[model samples]
Target: MSWDPYATLGLGRTATADDIRRAYRKLAKELHPDVRPGDKAAEERFKRATAAFNLLSDPALKSRYDRGEIDADGNERMAFGGGGPRPRQSARAGAGAGGFGGGPQGGPAGGADAFDLGDIFSDLFGPGFSGGGRGYGRMRGRDIRFTLDIDFLDAVNGAKRRVSLAEGRTLDVAIPAGVESGQVLRLKNQGGPGVQGGPSGDALVELNVRPHAFFRREGQDIHMDLNISLTEAVEGGRVQAPTPSGPVSLSIPAGSNTGKVLRLKGKGVGGQGDQFVRLLVMLPEVPDEELKRFVKKWPKRDQAPPRPS
Candidate 1:
């Protein structure tokens, strides 16, 4: 494709360096391979945007490009003098098979111009390519980020999950126990592939723990409300209670009212915290005729609970 650094970065010739940077960052965040795995079109756009950024980020390169001294690929344009555009002078007199940006073959000089591809690469890849070095330089790959939604139990108990990547690839990620929402798990060497022999980047996975139906967590403690019949609350007996691990037996105290809390040690997050079970005394949905009649005649029924002062 015809590379236009300004257009690729969604900018114009009048755009400032800061403007260019902002545009590139916005596009990279939206078009990065990790954001939309296996989307070729976005990946291509990402690569183009990166290339454009590299070119435009460097002041010298940006100036040269703006002046039409070099093309989008960093190859020098036809050598133009004060008079007008002119062909680059070939080193070989007869061999006109010039390298990049050289005159066409069989031109003034039969041989191609001795252009150093390494020099061009050194300008683009940033440092380490100089000192008369040849071939592509090494550059570290870009870091990738992803969001992984997991069940609340899985966050409390360490679990393994597979993360999907581009090209039908998968990465196994280990979620630590007691991981909270917004926590990031980093996998080294799991991002975009490096350029040449450079090292690959890391993969950052942010956790999004899904909410439970009735259970809530505070710090390391677990809290839930357990409904109990009026008989069980007044008589005080053992009843089944729900926990993250499983159902457990709970003892209710006599005359227990609503908002009574029961603590189960070592039954919370990671089996190290505590579970607070609040008792909710509930009456039958329908009124019982026999109970209603008995209450009306009972003398103690007139004794109401003391109200707050």
Candidate 2:
């Protein structure tokens, strides 16, 4: 898709170089791939945003684009009279070796289209006797790859970022939500220049998401550990638990044990995965003298013993 550079950068046609740089930097911080890695949508936006910025960042290119010589996507428009601004000649030169009456080959008078074709071929290949040779060599630019690392929360919520190229150029990337690792983002014609007027290659950005301390992702679900005291587990009460959205209250059933799992629905990334709270019973390292005495004097008369069949 053709994107308007000025509109993408939030600037006018008359914006200065300094203004463009500042705007790019500001948007880059929020949309860079490093800030929202593993997000496919965000990566696509980043590519488009950077492509727009790259086209507008160069003064000469921007001028040419503004003058209607090229489109926003950097495609040269066909000028008037066919290829360029050059003028065409009349049909006399194209006639079959004679005047309008007749030709040496006994054919009708050649039209302007024949003359134009001859002119184009003569300009391109230097007046060949006949058509037996191919024209132009193939030249392709090198492909560029960018690796971006994003924070866990930013990957989930989406963010913007800036990436600095080897040539000292910076790109503004917009990261979208719900991206995954190893996703490739392609920016067409944004790579190295062609050797002999051939089209440029592309820039590819790969995504990498950072790990979260509290949240462990399983597919789309998020898992977390919830610590509950012995009293709360025995009495069954509402306890606050940590989730990606924030802390939420969870009901602990009476007589709950360690390793018990409580599920909180729609609390994961994109609100599609369930948040599992794995209960961990934390025991005090040191016990008081009274507690020790009570534990020592506890009755076990009703306790049942294991029987083997």
Candidate 3:
């Protein structure tokens, strides 16, 4: 029977990372082996819970599993199933893919339907291999895993990455939009060649998104501190701020203070998340004497109970 992590964890395809984590944690607490000693069902459920959580925890693995690229255990499934893309099977009586002429080892046995001893003997002592008490064909190719380092900006705004292989070959990986660090990008039929004409494997590329100096991400949301002038903060106006899409005008509230967060909707990763801009007042390196004088000479307000600043 095939394994479905979603079924094991009682989740759906639309489950997010947080939802997965929450579900796994709840199941682990309930199905913990220690809590139900000597219960085989509990132990098995516990093991399955762990496996499902581990598989679905990684964004890349979850994505691949959802797309049916890989199985619950991270093994690649034949993309073309049910006789799809099969190497030419031997349908001849004696003339296999590389078998001999239709006849026995004692020359060509006469008859339109002669008994092909070669076919019989080959089946007896042929190259067919078995595993776990079951006969099977040649093994499929092995998947190759690579860790690719990409720029923060490139990660935010997806870009194409060319990976150089040892055999003087290159692979083009299409980094998807809003792809996070540690997410996998699976390239189909790009790994080592198939064994004895079996299906080729895949190339699993794990993305390593470099961190930006001023910008950081949480899920799809992006956060950054915007340096607003004192004048801009005092007098609310439209101010331009740098975003992944480019510089965008943001309206700052009048009398805004430090630590105020302004939201720019649909400006984050792939424009699906909101960009949070924290207002930070930047002071000039050289103090303005005129400004200081104005403050010094300004009328003082009555000392009242300080409200929330």
Q: What is the C-alpha lDDT of each candidate?
A: 0.64, 0.56, 0.61
User: Which candidate gets the maximum lDDT versus the true structure?
Assistant: 1
lDDT of 1: 0.64
Per-residue CA lDDT of model 2 for 1-309, tens digit only, reads 334768877898898766766675566456544556677665555444444554565555566668854455544332121112321121111111111111111110133211122232344445751112311121233344455667776666677877765445665666676667666567776654532244565555566777888788887788888888877887889988877667888999998888889899998776877888899887666767876676678796457656697
Root-mean-square deviation (CA) per prediction = 18.8, 22.2, 19.8
Kindly list the per-residue Cα lDDT of model 3 for residues 46-155, writing each as its tens digit. 65655565456655556666875555654444321122222222111111111111110011112343222223223434533221121111224445455667778888
Off by over 4 Å in 3: 1-137, 301-309
Candidate 3 RMSD to the correct structure: 19.8
Tell me the deviation in Å of residue 100 in model 1: 28
By how many angstroms RMSD does model 1 differ from the true structure?
18.8
Per-model TM-score on C-alpha atoms:
0.60, 0.50, 0.56
Candidate 3 achieves a global lDDT of 0.61
lDDT of 1 by residue, 201-284 (tens): 566666778899999999899999999998998899999998888899999999999998999999889897999999999988
For model 2 the TM-score comes to: 0.50
